[model samples]
Target: MIWLRKTRLILLMLRGMLICATVFPWASVAMRERLIRNWSRKLLKLCGVEVEVQGLAPGQPAPRGAMMVANHISWLDIYVIHSWHPARFVAKSEIRSWPLVGWLCEKTGTIFIERGRKRDAHRVLHHITEVMRDGDLVCVFPEGTTTDGTEVLPFHANLMQAPVAGGLPVQPVGLRYLDAATGEPTAAPAYIGDLSLLDSLDMILRSPPIKARLVVGQMLHPMSDNRRQLAGFAREVVADLARADLVAAAASVSRAHQVEAKGADQPATV
Candidate 1:
């Protein structure tokens, strides 16, 4: 069993790290986006995981200078978001010391955050403010803690403070895992603890193919609403994710419903 775990870890450490250190650096920021975009796709394939975008409108690219507020789930959520929006992850301070992952993220310019440390939070806030002023998008998981993908947790408003510095529009994202065949969303998707990347990868290496559904809800305008209100908005978005395809396709249904009802008097003859 240890041999199997080592096998997956070694592969991830090599491929994921080498790709970032060499290929990821030479590329300019613009070129970096292309590199990461392609790189993330390749990484997903290696992991044997498939990603699908839900609830994003056609032609809607992630905001150029925006704050993306995502709910916490599996550690792999980082990859999914970056693959969509080229940005730095707002990760816990602990992740800053995580072996190869830490090194890889640091080299790629990830902004580390220390929750509950007032001073550290302030520093991260200002740092990200500068990032935004420089026109970079920032991804923040307000949930503060990981969940089993079964429910949305509370949003820690402290991180939202950075966006308020400039009325930064917040993009709320809802992520979930599904039974590929049944299309049922389930919490078994959440990954927590020392679920080492290698161990997680090994799990995927054997199981039946699983698809991760990432739903990008509408961008929320920064409001006077405290973190609780913001958390509320984020939760609503996640709740709506249960019927993602239907939600995305229902505008016409509502429109037709209204139009058909309007002719009730005329249609009575039928």
Candidate 2:
């Protein structure tokens, strides 16, 4: 059954490649977005991940031309976000080496930056600002690297310059992965610590259903032209959302344990 699921996903990915090869180049901007959003949702379904969005309504209009900053945990973060809101993403140049996925991302307008190069940020920032000024939603994972979904990392403010240059508001997004049935935090979807893509996929494909919780924070207005300050403030907001979810999950687990203990204390009725 797992193999079947993987097969379907692989087929779907090939289909995505075909579309990217042909239709993407000639498609209208609106058409391209629809395809990307729909395809991303299908891809998640094949991977057994469902999205649970908070702080935004179904079909809600995202802030146009705004810079979206979010924590990164796994490669699926891109599609998970795209399933709801189709935005051009800024990713590391290394992703360009991934098999079909890299090509797909490139075809769909992902801006890749070479890590460790200070000058590369300026180059990428120019592209990001241009897209934002063109009224496109551009997303950046300022954390720069993937974590295990339990904590948020410090954000690099280099890319934050896009918002400051354009005077655009920044939207902070929080992501958490959990077991669908138990509603507890899960690590099956986390692609951290030198794990190969195949290994990560094996874990997710063999685990229980996963729920990706997305929390969209308020749009932050630029008070000063300081990118570092803005990045710090945005990180705090996103971290608060992650902490709140963790607290709620802990409370849920505690309640379940109490219920179990009370049941065990009672004598058998029949």
The positional error of residue 187 in candidate 2, measured at the CA in angstroms, is 0.5
Reference-based TM-score of each model: 0.80, 0.88
Best by lDDT: 2
lDDT of each: 0.68, 0.84
Task: Residues 103-203, candidate 2: write the lDDT tens digits.
Answer: 99999999899988978978888989888989999998888889998889999998888998888888878899999999999999999898999899999
Name the lDDT value of residue 125 in candidate 1: 88
Question: What lDDT does candidate 1 reach at residue 166?
Answer: 67
For model 1, how big is the CA root-mean-square deviation? 9.4
lDDT for each residue of candidate 1 in 1-270, tens digit (9 for 90 to 100):
546545655686678678777777576898877767666765665555588987767897677677877777777788777777668878877887888778877866789877678888889889988888788988887777787776676677777777766666666677777666677764444677767665666665565556777777666555442445554555555545534644642443344334434533343342
**Among all windows of ten consecutive residues in candidate 2, which has the lowest summed lDDT?**
248-257
